[model samples]
Target: MRIKYAIPIVFFVALVIIEKENNIISRVSDKLALKQTPQAPIHTSRSGNALPKRNVSVTSLGKPSSAFTLMKRHLEKYSEHQQAAAAVTNGRKDILLLATTRTGSSFVGEFFNQQGDNMFYLYEPLWHVEKMLTLETGGTNATATAKAYCDVLRQLFLCDFSLLERFIEPLPVDHITASLFRRESSSSLCREVVCSPFVKGVYERYRCRNMRCGPLNLTMASESCLLKEHRAIKVVRVRQLETLRPLAEDPRLDVKFIQLVRDPRAVLSSRMVAFPGKYKTWSNWFMNSDVLIDDNEVKKLKSNCDNIRMSVELGLRQPVWLHDRYMLVRYEDVARLPMKKASEIYKFTGIPFTPQVNDWILKSTQASKETRGIYSTQKNSAEQVEKWRFSLPFKAVQLVQKVCGSTLKLFGYKFVTSEEMLRDKSISLIEDFL
Candidate 1:
């Protein structure tokens, strides 16, 4: 009996040693294979320009490798498989309503936001990144800030809120936070399933009065996102369209981009009213009748115009990836013919023109008077289009025309040669074509 027990014990010890040796060998082989693998070649556009590479660093957030990091890596590796699977499932459509501030983005965003129950719409999800990680706020440079914005957007698109939670003020506890920017703008977040124990129909009023709905449960938000057939995010923070090429190329997403542009002069005019604090200098210049062509504000305006023109030019080039996936819609066109333009936009996005959306368009575009709030979407859109001509000084208009000449021409906005031409509603400023 003793001899039998001794033989079994020795066999067990020997087996353990063998297993340990095999584990070590396997790890070594993996390392060798990894070392031998060549780096992926640089991706290039159809025009043979090298694409910008994202420097993905898990340590950038000062946390250990988390679910978001792992998911990003997994997606990168298995994107082809995921794309095939998505195709089989009839794929979730992702639309980016890309625009600049004070350019009627909020009103246009409602086109997707009010698209009934099947759509998950996020308004300015990048607001947190822009708010938190700016040079003045977080001591980070433009490149870092841009990376953070891109990372946050990518995670949001994947319905993974882990990365975004990091940027929220007063960090989330148990993935629950009330700090989500523009939470009320997202109807899905206000749904019964996500924010429970609330008055069903009076979410806005209830939320405003009592704050009874409590903080948003990001876990629930993610679950809600997964159930939606499509997702749309309206963003004003992303400056360069090329910066988003990777997102458009993402295999798990059927991404479509609608570049919503407005007349830069109108944009400047609107910005002056909407962000009076920031544009105080411009207001002072206008008030004092002192317009400097080479001022900092004027240079910034030129930079903005140049950026928009460049982005528009890139879309027009129609690289293989963006071919048929990109569109340019002027705010003026959409404003002039809401229903017709909405129909065209909906058709372009492959979403149905539901009765709910039609009703919303009819009601929203026919406001007897503009709402008090600067951000309010309700407006007499056709009348609102040329309202800038009255508010913006002729001198300011000429200055904008000078700085944004290329952009204005590219978007088919006619330069107002005089105050009369600018104010005359009958003299159409929008050309039929470029």
Candidate 2:
């Protein structure tokens, strides 16, 4: 009986040992399976929200997650903010008074030109570029001409006159030229400091005439530009705003654009009077009552209208590059309320409205009699805004409306269906545009 009991105990001990060994093997198998299986990647959701925490390590060479990309973009935007702040802190502000011809750019440009000694203004610096290109190649290569215009403008804004000298008529001799386009319009250019060794004290119109002042020394102009706190340029030759992207994006400069627009009908009327020689064909068409939409001159007008409309629309869309950097002002609005509009413009340009600007606006807009010079800025602006109605024939008005219908609508210019409506000054053609 004792031997049998001992045998059963031995069997029981064997069974217990075998069971323990099997349990250990199952645990080892489970660990091996866990090691071989691939784990899901640790990442944020597509919306950039973080995922629940897990015990996982990401490799250095792994793909960037959505959160990483978002953080990178944020860093880049912050860098842009820092750069813009640095620009503002440097006391350098560049203003581009952009407009088309016959859009009251000259008159409006005076807002900056008369801003005392702190402002350096350039009037139509692109004129030289356009004139030279037209003479050299009849401006057939539109791309080349556009590039040349932008290059010259970029240099001018940076106070470098070397590029501009190449285009000046009788090419600037030793950086001196008598024919800086519209030199009289820039107070900075006319000052005793820039004219040099000629006029004394403040610039007197008669005393500092090109004959008396001799040729403009571009070196002196550049020096004056560096001394000024701000630089402003008024240009009408820039047909497309997108062409200036390089200048606008330059990190070395802080640029702003104020685009001035006018009614297409008024612009056409003013162009006819200001450029009678060029518009003689249009005048003949008017006299003969034979205006055709397909005529080259009419086509040119349509192109101009389209260009202006496209630029204005682009600006209004507030592209990332143009954010807080573009403004649009109508000529009629500026004309009817010169002081208020000038204040608004000055505010937009980040400049102080001075007594000089105020006095000039008062004198310019309140003229007793209309100044008849083709390029004159002095006028009774209130009267001049609608003088086109008298000068432009009803037929011409109808033609402009048909060709520039979209532009007119976009710019808040009302169309006249009858000659009586064209002649009625009491009826306001300008609708309020926010």
Displacement of residue 425 (Cα, Å) in model 2 is 1.3
The list of candidate 2 runs beyond 4 A from truth reads 1-86, 198-207, 290-294, 370-372
Which candidate number maximizes TM-score? 1
What are the runs in model 1 whose C-alpha is more than 4 Å off? Answer: 1-76, 135-140, 197-212, 290-294, 370-372
TM-score of 2: 0.77
Residue-level lDDT for 152 in candidate 1: 66
Quantify all predictions' global Cα lDDT against the true fold: 0.75, 0.77
Per-residue alpha-carbon lDDT of candidate 1 for residues 1-434, written as tens digits (9 for 90 to 100)? 89989999999999997786545434333322232134322333335575443332233333356788778777766966665476538757888998999888899899888898899989898887666555223343444455566666776776666666665676666666767777877777777767745445532322422245767777677778877888899999887888778777666667889999999988998998888998988887887865544488888899899988999899999999898899999999999888988899989888888898889889988876545367778888887788898999899898889989999999999999998888898999899772
Clashes of 1: 0
What TM value does model 1 have?
0.79
